[model samples]
Target: MKKILLSIGGLVLLVIAVLLVAPLFISLEDYKPEIAAKAKEATGRDLEIGGKISLSLFPTVAIEVNDVALANYEQGQNKDMVTLEQMALELQVMPLLSSEVVIDRFVLVKPIINLEIDKTGKPNWELEGTQAPANETATTENSESSDGGSGAGLSGLSLGDVRIENGELHFIDLASGAKEDIEALNLEISLEALNEPLSLDGRLDWKAETINLKADVANLESLMNGGSTALEASVNSSPVNFSFNGTAQQASAFALAGALDLDVPSVKGLTDWVGAPIERQSEETFGPLSVKGQLDLNGSVVAFDDVSLAFDALTAQGALKIDSSGSVPNIVAALSTGVLDITPYLPPETSGGQDASSESTSDGGGAVQNAGADQGWSDEAIDFSGLKSVNADLALKSEGVKIRKITIGVSELGILLQGGKLTADLKQLALYDGQARGKVVLDSSKATPTTAINFDLSGVQAEPLLSDSADFEKLLGTLSSKANLTTQGASQKAMVSNLNGTGDFIFQDGAVKGVNIPGLIRNVSLDALQNSFDEAQSTDFAELSGTYTIQQGVVNNQDLSMIAPLFRLSGKGTVPMPPKTLDYRLEPKLVGDLEGQGGDSGAKGLAVPLLITGSWSDPKVAPDLAGALTDQLKDPSALIEGVTSGEGGVKLPLGDGDDAGGVEEVIEKPKEALQKLFGN
Candidate 1:
């Protein structure tokens, strides 16, 4: 035993002497080629050492290597995969006597690492003949037992300080054409225990933004071994500031609980700082934001509780969860707010701040001009791709909501998303002193996106609703309506071309201005019709109801009816949505006829068929003389007897022109008998 001990001590002294004296006796550069050859044989990559290599023996033994590089993979475009300006490892001399390896400090300077995955989805780090994880694990265990190893190799291992200065890491994905670079990274760590806690301080340059961070970890070894650890972290920067106190686990056995705080001066500015900026049509400041939340996460699921977010003029609180364990992510949330203002998200209001009622003129001229100018419904394509991004169910409530002149009071809305479909349910909506309920669903599961809306609104003001919804302000009353509609399209015009729906509407105690049906049906001239069709000549109705069906964007109203004191009107019409036009024929007759019963054109007391035709905003109403003539002559025998023999009925007065006598001759060759009956 003494001989063995003496021999080991002598060997240790010899190694110490060599470490101290070698650099002076020999040039290390002479062995560089052999060292490079061994490294290449082991790693299958080129190794270059352009700078000095040195060894020291003092309070601590140390080795330093400078200006080293490794060759890249065969598929990489660059020649070098990694390069280092300097690297050093220091060891405690006392540990060597006990057969223990204890590191005093580790340092790296100006290191650059490049990592990549190729188009074939193979990472550059993957090596040929690499053992599977199970095999690797068994091999490691067998090797350790055979070598009679202590834990972590030569047991009593300890490390004090670790420092990295001016480092860079780059990751590239050739398939996705994505490149991420982290530059000017520096890290400093102070260790308190070998396995329990680590104090970290770090900073980096990202997208020209400086990020300073600090973190403390307890049980870092446990985390590395797929277990839980406690963490506290904070980040400070110009674009955003964030902090968290949490328990974090590994990705496979994921678990997290934390409190998070975040602040941002402007969302747009923050996005720009990250090298991506949103493109929006409206020019407005998007946000000055603050957020606070309690987070709990397990596996592929994440949840936030007691969450509050304040951005711009909107303040909201919610509980939110996202589950990504499935084929696609699912998100569920419920949020509530007070006085939500969505004005900035809309297109700038054209007739800004003008009273809604003032958009129309009594003469109906301005209505046409305005409608033509605006041509409602934008032609720009609406991207619905976001609806398919995740499956979600969300509920939102607000005390009040406003978007330009449109306002809603006490509203609750729910949104559901799944399988590339999104449904928005207005479970409760109070607007314009009324209530509304509806469901709107957008589905992209088909070849093209399709939408369905089923809605009911009651006790709503007609004029304001129309003005806000469709820029129409011609009618005033309380309205009730129900509609079920479906359409498929990528744009407004496409939707119009494929629209299909059914709806019914009832207006109570309403008045429609700018046209007089009775006067126009009385065979009045155009000038006379326009004169009496002024605002003062509006027709008042006790009840007006219509049931309509829409096919291919053309709305057909076949059961249109109106009740008034002096007249009862029934009409039918087609409103073609794409052209923004209306065509209708209304048959209006007096309340009582000679038989003391209401009648149509034949039973008479000025039952004229009034035709309304024109652009929707400026329709023209006139007496259909040609149609009346056609109806009058449907029985040619009756027309011959009424004009010639005066047996069918007395001929209705034809016109205010002197050609009244010539009217009979105009139909045929100057019928002498008809001319004599008219005394022509």
Candidate 2:
């Protein structure tokens, strides 16, 4: 029995010795052709091993291969899809006997991978042959078996160091003409055991920038077993830096709750580095941005609480949540800021200020001329497609807000958007020293978008408001206005042409900055006269009120009324917004005093008809000679009596051909009074 046992031991020893020493005489390179042939049959791609192959066993099992490559698709741009200068792997043989995989070092050196998508949407990574449909029962059984064995499979797994040195990955989309390249990717990973901590550190050069990345898992086993584990990760790059520290779990689904910090030196720079540069209206936009918050991600829902965000010199604190489980993402946010100045991101206001000298002069036939007519509203299409990409509910409050040259104070706004329709409620707003509240609804679901606004403004300072908003600084007053307007269009020109609205406005204790009505009427002449409103000359009034209706961009106001110390004025007009022209008539009557707001019957005086016509930018102001003559003749007895009594409040020159006094000529021949009075 002892001799037989000895024989068995000797045979086992001989087998072990052979297993340890057999690799010395054998050459793995000799079977390279067979290996390549098998790989081609499996993948339908040529696999080439140009250099030497070495293998070892016994104390450590190791394999090394050099100069390996895989052929690209027949229609691929590159000759070789993947190439590796060298690959080496080492494993502990003793651990394999215990159902464990303990890797000493697994390294890949200078591997290049080219991933391409053809113009026909075919990818090079897709093998030539079709794959058989997976069996449901078999797949379910396999998945259950794998899940049941996962713990045991990974229980004894260990890794000393796994590394990739200077690898490169290229991606190209032929249909989109887009290319992306990651060069010099060096990574190192270390795992003592499945139950212990795991760490990874890596660096990559992309788009002429280097990115440093690191991650740590406190307990890899716990994480794999659907339990929570402490996790920390960071990515640092020239354009942006991001870091997160928190707990991660994968119980029913992956989830995380942690603190995240992200800083971007310049969004534009980061976008450019990613080969997706964004276009901005101003150079000042897309500048520095930073965010810090507590993030909770559960399934497809992500929430950020106590978020502090800074962008383009504007800072705010907010809470935001996003749910992507639906067809479109839904966002909810509440933000507040001290002063939100978004002027840098706003498009510049058009240059619309006209010079005072551009007004009508003697050479222009008394017609006011604008320095230059605006090019008109932009016809560029307004893209509302983005609005349909997501649904959002947002509430924003700010101590002050600035957009372009317009400044507003203490505003609270709530916006809700769903299915390409947006409703904005201005709950509270202080604008131009006034209170403004309004609601705006925009529907972009249709082919042609539509907008409706119901706004009310009171006690607003009109001068500064108009100056900043529209470059119209001629009127100074406390203004109150209400408007309910609706329009449908995708472009400014179309919107204005389709506008329909009803509004009423009142201006109190104001002055018309450019014109003195009395002076203009007193200096009446058939020849051209200056009617510029940009000068310091003005007419003070107690009130100016009007109710207007707009249809197809044409505004008509028939009850315009003004009260002044020396005169009462009434006007009616049509303002075509599309053409930016005005056709208005004003009748001003001399009043006895500033009493009863021009309603006192005793304050009536001579009435002169004045006409304002032409573009809003340059209106022509002149007396309606025919209308005035007819008005005076309608009440000839009162006019003559007043003229004889020297209380007509008017003076006309007698004919130059005759030495007739003006009053006598007017009293003697009422029928031909105007003809005689004008020396006709």
Candidate 3:
């Protein structure tokens, strides 16, 4: 029996010897033409083998080739689809008997691959006459292999030294004129066996950035055979760093569930590196960004739970899902944050000087600081094109929020965007000590965009709200307001000109900051009227209420009423928003004595009509002396009665200063009293 086993072993040794010496007798170069012809017949492209090819068999079966190239499609942009400087492969012979592939060495040096898509969407990689038959065979094989019954498949595989040095891959799309080149790619891969861990480390230069990548798969065979395996991967570059620890599987489609961490030192830098730049409103926007999450991705859908995101000065935690199976990607998220400061993402405030007063105003919530026709509003077209890119439903809650100069507290908002229309619903909002509920809709689906806003606010501090929104700090109060407004346009001026709305506001225990109605009436001089906007000349009011309607950019208010200690004030006006001009008239009736006593007596002292005109930035104030004199001319005796007893009609104080004897002299000749009082 020992002799028989020795004889079998000796036969095996003889066979191995013959295999080792086989290459000595046969020249692989002689068959290079046949190999090239076969490849050309299969792919319908020229194959050139320019250098030597050698083969060996002993400890391992090996083949090495140099200078090989394959031609691209005739109409392709590149002449050669692939070019290789050198390639070597080694396989362990003993592993074949056990249905295993053990690669001792597999190295590719200086390999260049060029992939392209023509303008007609034809890819150079799609070899001629290879699609239908290859797909059919793959489908049949996949179906047979689904039951794990394919004997032709390897049972185990191992890679010893697999390396790629200085490899390059280039992709060009003719239709989009986009080109991507990945050069200076060096890679090393290792695997013990099919079920053993596989590791890969590589570096590549892409888009002027050097990227280092590392990956590990716990079981490479399981992953390839429609099973799950543990995976860890990291990619590091100057612009960004990303790492993932996950379980990956490929059954019907590739799927991954993982913990992912990504950090971008500058999102703007990343975008610029990737050849896509974002337009930022401020220098601080789109700067640093980071994300950490538990992520699950299945084909076209990706979900993130326990996700924390930080961008610029904003930080939030959320559960987010994005599904790209539809025409437009759809995102659903629920996020909450401590304080969300969005000012960095807003456009900078307009700067310059105004004509008279440097104050601004707002209608609804749109700041009209630059809403005038000539120089106020910007003529640049507002672009809403990005709204059509995706759809989203987002629920956000924040302890506090800051947008531009306005600060809000304890806010809950729901945002829904679909078909180029975005709606934001303020569920719970606190702003400047006020509670507000509102909904804003922006529809960009049409040629001309449209916006609609409805808001109700109560118990709001008016001073800060106005100051923040419009840079106007003239009014102070606790305010309650309601507004329903709509506009359609593509620019600030056009939108404001098209604005139409109805609103009402009521203020309690407030003072007009820059005007003293009682003092203006008492002095009865042009100088007093001109200086009415002085900061020290404020008139305190117990209550102020007004209702207004807007039409074609003109706000018309006819019921402005204020109850003050020295006078009852009423106003009617038209403010044209497009021009930022005011044509308002305010009437102050002195109902109380100079000592503040006649408020309850119902005695009418005097009525002064004041006209406010010019730009909202620099309004002019003057008394309507002509109108007052007309009333006196009609009722001369009534003027005398009012001047003497402070009762019957509109009265005029004669002297520039407040003196009772001046009224007595004016009472004798009321017409002469009016002329002297007016300086006529």
Candidate 4:
């Protein structure tokens, strides 16, 4: 029995030796033509196979090809369009025993694929007029056959291990002049077949610039066929080091189910990647961005959570969701920052003196003055013409943004701001004082791009408003006011012409300094003329009430009056606020009691029934009043010196002088006294 067992074992060993050594006698060159013919029949192209086959062991096969070239046979041109070089394959030993061929390993090296799209936008590779092969058939007889059935059996090839080393791939769009190249590529793959389904594990390494990426992918085949695949990748460089992990089928689907981790040395670099316009000339630089996030994707909808990004210049972190299912993609994103420097994004000023002069002259002579309190306006107001909606939670720490031609309208109020600037703690919408807090709303609905503002301002200094104007020199006291102003039209000049608004203004402890309204009134005083006022009132007393209209810096008052002991006064005038000049005509009336007191009352009323007058710009009160008083009292120096030295009140002295003279003389001279008092 032992001898018989030994003989059986020796026979089995001999059979294995014969099976392993038989392929060594089979010449690999003899199979080249058959391999080429099989590839051509399968791909519908001319194929060149230059590879050596190895069969040193039973049921195991290996093919190493130096180069394999495929050509488009439909073109009549004999040039090879696609080439595979240094290709190799290794097969499992078990498939040979089953009369079936299954590849366990496949590898490609330096494969160059060239594709051309003609002017007609047709790719050269597409089969022009060929019919597709009929559906494949399966039979038990072919399955049992040793030669792997028929010539059409190549489709059944299954690979278990695949790798590409030191390869280069390029995509060129011929018609668009666009080219994309990937170089220095290396890849390794391991896969297995289960229930006729392929499962793969992959590792890839690539480089571009100083950046290097290493990635691991799992379930790669399933991922290509609408099943989930998981991937984790890490990038390293001097300025950047980041990692990310997620599951995705395609790049577009990354927005749905991808998680990204970033630790970059510069936020500016990230901004550049995301397409924000940051000026290259700015001196300000941002530090690194540290970000981590996860994305949930559902077709065209994507939602992001656990998103956080930080920079040295600002702290920005937020969640965002995007919907691309509509005609126009809509993005709803919320971002908040601890601090941000947005100066780089601000509009650049127009250079050269010509632009400055043009802007200065465009206001139609309305003057702008420097603020006494330094409201922190570094540049001129921006022109709000083409601005759309702005939705950002921003904290700004610079000066402030100036807006020109701010036309605003609410239901009851309308205003036009020529050149106004406002400064606020933007994050809180509060002034530095903390008491003043408000939001500004601008509406440009009427004219697509025209700006209209509706704002509620409180606890603001009134002096800032007057200081911004060219006319008034200074204003005293703190002021708080709320207004709603709007204007129509496009530009500052045009808006003023078409401007219409109504606002109620109130002042507390407000006083105008370096402005002498009394002097102006005296220069245009009606005391020199007859029938100015019907009643006899003290010269020291005066009251004014009427609607005044200003146009092109000229003020016109239609109904004005003045009362004096000897005469009543009335007049009309054109007063220019800037440059401070006026022209007027006055008529004086004798008082009834004064006429009853003496026969000369009619003479007083008759003197200078109308006086025409003009005055200098911004005249000094003391000198102007001295001139008028010298003309009326025949002793100007006394009254002028009296008021200038603070010895006596000028208005009361003039009133006493009016009582001393007859009604006629008093009425005539009081006008001179008024002229002296007002420096007109």
Candidate 5:
């Protein structure tokens, strides 16, 4: 029995030895040529395969490939040139149980690729080309294999570890003439093709002249029959050091959709990376337009936190939102700041043009004439609906600057400027001590642009406001004024309709400055004029209050009063801006009933009556002395018959009875004759 058992044991050992050593005769070197031929046939290109194979007594087989390279082939190009590096596959056990191959690891290293795009934006790789005979045969075989089962081609392969080192990827932007290259990438993947689900992890490093990036990806998978892919990735770059992780889903070819959340600590570097300058502007210095902030973006939705931009003396910070998905996108942004000098960015005005104050002419004369008629405004009409929303805070400061906000709808009637605020600090504006605040709204819906203006003007010394403007210095002494005004109109012609406002005017001690009634009256006291002419020139006072209203081109002043002259005045006139013309009539009345009072019964006791009637085209001022003289001397010609004409007063002749009409009908008269003879 012992002898029989030993012989049985020996037989069992012999069978095991044969099973382990059988693969040794299957030399991998001998199979290299056939494998290379098959690979060439499959890819339509030449293939080179090299590797070492080993068999162990444990009944295991392992193979390692040093390198595999493929050649590029075209109808007339050099077919021997290497175009791509073939993947090196390493198998630890071949034909596991004699039916499938199990790959323990695979590595792809330092592969170079080239791509070219033509002027027509087509890629060279997409062009049709001839295929080698071996490649055609291999492709036919692969198709037959696929027909055997849905995944039969890849079902026999299993991998434990896969890695790629120092790989490079590049992208060329044909439209922008830019090329982006990513290099120094390392990746590791473990996949089992026959398994239910697949997984992968990769890491990459990218270097460029102005930027550097490193990223990591993990837990990648394709689920629901390739309808969705899930993964987590983090990317870090020198410019905008931030990271994002998310899941993405795709719907056939319609779209690639996903949502990603991110956190960013600082965007200063990011701004710099994008070639945005960082600096500030001073009164004597100019600075970069810099901005920094934390932003969140999900698909088309974006949000900002603590964002600011500095341009010269202006700094603006705000939050805004845009929706760019519709036919007409809209934008809603709110920004605020203390002061801003926006003059540098304003459009250059045409030469020899009328200023803001000049009424708009049919030829586009006012400031709003060519306001936004430029390419910049036209390009801003792109739809922004794809952008979500934003909220922000901001500030700006500048001298001689105008802040304007205008909105125009593509299909709307006209442009609407919600408002505009202007500040002038130039010496000419007297803004050194001058400051003005105002808001103007324009409604262009009408055939003409209608404007509403509300403004507060202060620190305007009358002398300066009128210095270069007119002859105010000749009549009124040094003067200053403060006024609050509101007006609405569609055009110069329409401005006369229902215009009303009030003003407080003050004149310093000096000779009457302008040609107005108050300026001409000087320091005359009615009582003193009646008492003796002595005290009339000694008194000095300055101040006035008045309100004016306009309707149907006629301006009327009901509360015109002055202290130095101590007189009350009423006036009416028409002021049209087109041809720039003014016509008015004024009646001056003494404050008290001097005729009834026990005042001096002299020329001063008589009412100091005055009348003004003239067109701005050519104005004339004279005294109403017709009733002052007795019947025999009542005629102005008789009163001035012997008086020598001087600079202060003059006299002229009167008409004969047949041709002379009523008192109002007398035509020619000397201005001085009326002033001296009537004492007004």
Candidate 6:
């Protein structure tokens, strides 16, 4: 028939020309010590091979190696755990001559791995010094294959393209001196039969950026039969962009369920690329993030449902869970946000000296400055060491919550930490129409950290929370507060000077905007310094309660009280608060029968103590006249009933600008000592 088909193609061209000259008479580097003793009997480390060992067989069986290395753990600095410059392989020589093994490409070109751990956490890719365990024919004759739970050993294998070039991956942790690297790694994989579908695309270079990754699995026999497969991953990087889309459950407990999606654009460069940096004391700048989620994981517990986060102009919604098999990784979350303008993470509002009588207690919400702990409170140095990193139980909520001009309308906050304590509750807080609840905890498991704080608030709105904390807009309206307090100090001026607390407050129809009390009882009004918080001489008050007590930072207010239908007030205090100064005493009375008066302040006509020293930002009120000369030495007609019931008339001035003796010569010597005791 054509010379019998040219004699069977001349015996297939003499067996492909004797398998291409049989590797040029085979000296394959003289079997390189049996190929480096079967790679040191399958990697018990040491496998040198310095260069050249080549072979090939008819468009199939190929192998080429040159300068490989691979050892590790003779201790530290580079015992070389893999280093290959040039490697190439191809198989399927008729299904590995029937032992069935496939693999048609495996190129490596410029690899350099490293992967260490040392300093006690021993790891240099393990497989230490004794190497002898690898039965099943050394798992398909080692071609670097071993994910073998039956089928990553790929049932009758068949992989095709895999080329990694310029690879590098050097990680180190010698006990947290943490180091990482993965440079210029390039990978491309595509498999054809571990039962279909699998592809990977990669690129590396970390920290100095450039990420790019992609993956797809799609079944692969349901991911080698451990169940649900279908995965698609993606990553891009500059400041983060990540993605994932789903289903990879139960591969021996590596379960998953995804839909991640992320974009960062710098959340401090993704926490400085995950090394966690955001140690703020205030040069804040978070940013451009967006999340979106539904992660799930189900094995070591890793949920994250519905999420949807954003930052910079805040917006949140969430659910989270973390659980990593315990030993310190447990988290829970629940979020909500919108309008959480924490002034771009704080520290920018600072304006402290103002007092033109505080401009008549300005309102429209901007005269109450100070807030953020009155321009201070962060003496830094509060590291709580990142709160030991994990254990949490967050819960944040917001809906209006600025933090500079201080405004809060709806808020809910909760946080918990275990093992080094850390509470923080406040569940539900609405201010300015008030309602609050509180808790604060913070115990760093001792050695001086302690801090507890109980709190309560109700019906709030006391002039913008005391004008954003003590800038004092001169009190006005429905308030209620409570505190329990405790401290151990770690700044904030040592927690307000090591405070030991006990607080209470109440306002109700309040007014006190700079005091006038009937013009200091008919004009003993010493020069009227714009009448204090003069909304037309404040002091309306239908109630203004108190109950303070803190020691060690001094503050004691013996049940101060004030009610004013005509007048009735009381006080006694000592506020040492790190020199916030103010030595208190304020007693005014005249609630009944004094003509323009209602009744029963004990039917008193007038009584006055009023001392109030200075420095809670300029205090100093007058009218004590040595307690009305000790009450006219015990009532010698008490200065003719304090000059006909105007106990504070005559301007008994004395805030060091003397004149405590001319109210009609002290009302004529208490009426000439009551007429020499009755001999009138």
Top model number, TM-score: 2
Model 5 stretches astray by more than 4 angstroms: 1-87, 91-103, 127-161, 170-176, 188-219, 222-231, 245-680
lDDT tens digits, residue span 1-680, model 6: 99999999999899989998888897888888886787777766678888887888976888889888977767868878888988998886777766667888888988999888878898777774455457855875664355545465456676787789978888988887899988889999887776677888988888788888988887676666577877888898888888888888656687778789898887876897778878543444586888888898877888889998887677899898889897778899998888886766765555565644343232232121122222334666566766766789899888878777778888889899887788989888888787889899998767668798998998888998778866778778898889898978666677778888889887777666645664454333334323332444456666678788898778898877776554467788898877677788877653322222233334343455667665664455566746744754575344455433545332221121111111222223444423322224
lDDT by residue (tens digit), candidate 5, 1-680? 99999999999789778857776666777877887777666665666754453444343444345455556434322333333343555564436666677776576666644444434566534533345589888998888666554345455666677777777666554655666566666666665654433445555554442223333323122322233444344444443333334444433432222233332333333444445644423233243344455444434545554556554556666654444454434444444343554544555434333345432222221111222211111212222222223211212232233332211111101111222212221112223244444444444434433444444444544444454344333433344554433444544444534344444444444333212332222212333222221212222324444455544434556544444332333444555433334454444322211121122112121123343333342333343334333332545443333232222222112222211111222213445434532445
Local distance difference test, each candidate: 0.73, 0.81, 0.81, 0.47, 0.41, 0.70
The RMSD (Cα, Å) of candidate 1 is 8.7
- Greater-TM-score candidate between 1 and 5: 1
TM-score of each: 0.78, 0.88, 0.86, 0.56, 0.42, 0.38
Candidate 4 lDDT (Cα, whole model)?
0.47
Ranking by TM-score: 2, 3, 1, 4, 5, 6
> Which ten residues in a row are the worst by lDDT in model 5?
407-416
Lowest summed-lDDT stretch of 10 residues in model 3? 657-666
135 Cα displacement, candidate 5 (Å): 19
Per residue, candidate 1 scores C-alpha lDDT tens digits across 1-680 of 99999999999889878867876787778888998987787677889999998767766888888999988889985678899999999988887888766777889999998899999888776544323589888998888777542333433556676889999988999998888889999999876444658789999998788899899988666665566789899999999999989898875657879999999988888988777897544555576899899989898898999999998888999899999999889999999998887877776656543354434333432212222322555577878877777899999999999877688899999998888888999999997888999999989877788999999999999888877776666687889999999999888888887899999998887767655554443334545555545655565566678899999999999877766543456789999898888798877643322121222323223344667777755565666656755664576555454333333333332332222111222233324433332223
Off by over 4 Å in 1: 1-27, 73-77, 96-101, 116-138, 141-157, 170-177, 347-386, 447-450, 487-498, 516-523, 535-537, 578-581, 588-608, 614-620, 625-680
lDDT of 4 by residue, 1-680 (tens): 99999999999899878877777688877888887777666667777766545545555667677777888534322256577778777777776666455777688887766666554566657753444444323454445454442322333345576777666655555567655555656666543432143333333332343446566666554454445667667777655787767876644353327787778776676555444545543445565677778878777887777677676555656676667776445555655444344545445644422233222111122111211221221233336633232222222222222222111111111122212212222233333221233344344434422433334444444555444433333444444444333444445444444333322323333333432222223333433211112123223322222345555435666554443333444556656533345565444433322222122322222112233333332221112233333443555444344222333323322222223213222222444544443436
Steric overlap count per candidate: 0, 0, 3, 29, 42, 3
Each candidate: RMSD to true structure? 8.7, 5.5, 5.6, 13.1, 14.8, 18.6
* lDDT, candidate 3, 100-168, per-residue tens: 899999999999999999999899988864345878889988878775732226556789999999999
lDDT measured at residue 590 in model 6 versus the true structure, 0 to 100: 38
> How well does candidate 6 match the true structure, expressed as C-alpha RMSD?
18.6
Error at 387, model 5, angstroms: 14
